[model samples]
Target: MDGATGFAVSALVNILLSLAGIALSWWVLQNVRLDLFLREPKGIQAKVLYILLSIIFGHGLASFLNDYMSWSQMLGSLFG
Candidate 1:
């Protein structure tokens, strides 16, 4: 494959990996029973928004941490 094609493939793969993290985070938050985490909202819309934000932030943070861990491991392997 050409350089451009390889770069595109890598970008696509990264996007998919991040998306998978997001989906898993959303699924776990929605289905996992955690009473403390669920705050009672005054309205349906507010509740929905809260959950949506939570999922987005949770997934994004998880994805970041995952990437960081992978990088750290790679660095350790390179240096050790």
Candidate 2:
């Protein structure tokens, strides 16, 4: 692929991965006892906190996956 096409594909993949990571994180977070940590677990603040935490964790997970993928792709050059 040309540089431009490669970049576009990479961008799409990154977006998809990040979204999947966020969804997965949100699903996983649902099982946690967030109520134990929050003084007003049933309030809007708790909901916002949950969303923020999901985003943070999801981004971290996505970043790690992206880095791992990038490193693996570079391995071809090392082996070539």
Candidate 3:
């Protein structure tokens, strides 16, 4: 992808990842008992942390996916 296209794609990926993170964090907080092993912050603080965690994880996953996809494209271009 060209620079502009790649930038746009990355932006979209970040947005999706952020949303996924929020959803995942919310579900985990609601369904799991984290207080047993962690400090277990409550209220907005807790939610914020979870959301942040999700965003970070999501970003990492997206990065890996992007890398793999790029590698695949490179290989295809070379071999096909």
Candidate 4:
């Protein structure tokens, strides 16, 4: 692929990975008992907090995965 095409593909992959990460984070967070830590677990603020937490954790997870994938791909250069 040309540079432009490669870049586009990479961008798409990153977006998909980020979305998947966010979804996975949200799903996993659903099992947590927020009521133990929040005074108004059922309130709108709590819902907003949940969304923020999911994004934060999801971004972190996605970043880690992206870096790992990049590093693994770079490994091939060592033997080439």
- What is the per-residue lDDT of model 2 for residues 2-64, given as tens digits with 9 covering 90 to 100? 999999999999999999999999999999999998899999999998899899999999999
Once fitted onto the true fold, the runs of candidate 1 whose alpha carbons sit more than 4 angstroms away are 33-80
Work out the TM-score per prediction.
Answer: 0.49, 0.96, 0.59, 0.96
Clashing residue pairs found in predicted model 1: none
Q: What RMSD, rounded to one decimal, does every model reach?
A: 4.6, 0.7, 3.4, 0.7
> Model 3, 1-80: lDDT tens per residue?
89999889978876776567556656655666654655655767676766677667666666666678678989999988
The per-residue C-alpha lDDT of model 4 at residue 49 equals 87
Q: After superposition, how far is residue 71 of candidate 2 from its true place, in Å?
A: 0.2
> lDDT: which is higher, 1 or 2?
2
Q: Which candidate wins on lDDT?
A: 2
Q: What does the lDDT come to for candidate 3?
A: 0.70
Better of 2 and 4 by lDDT: 2
Backbone clashes in each candidate structure, one number apiece? Answer: 0, 0, 0, 0
Candidate 2 similarity to native, TM-score: 0.96
Q: Which ten residues in a row have the lowest lDDT in candidate 2?
A: 47-56
- Candidate 2 off by > 4 Å: none
Whole-model lDDT values for every prediction: 0.69, 0.94, 0.70, 0.92
Runs with alpha carbons beyond 4 Å of true place in candidate 3: 1-32, 38-41
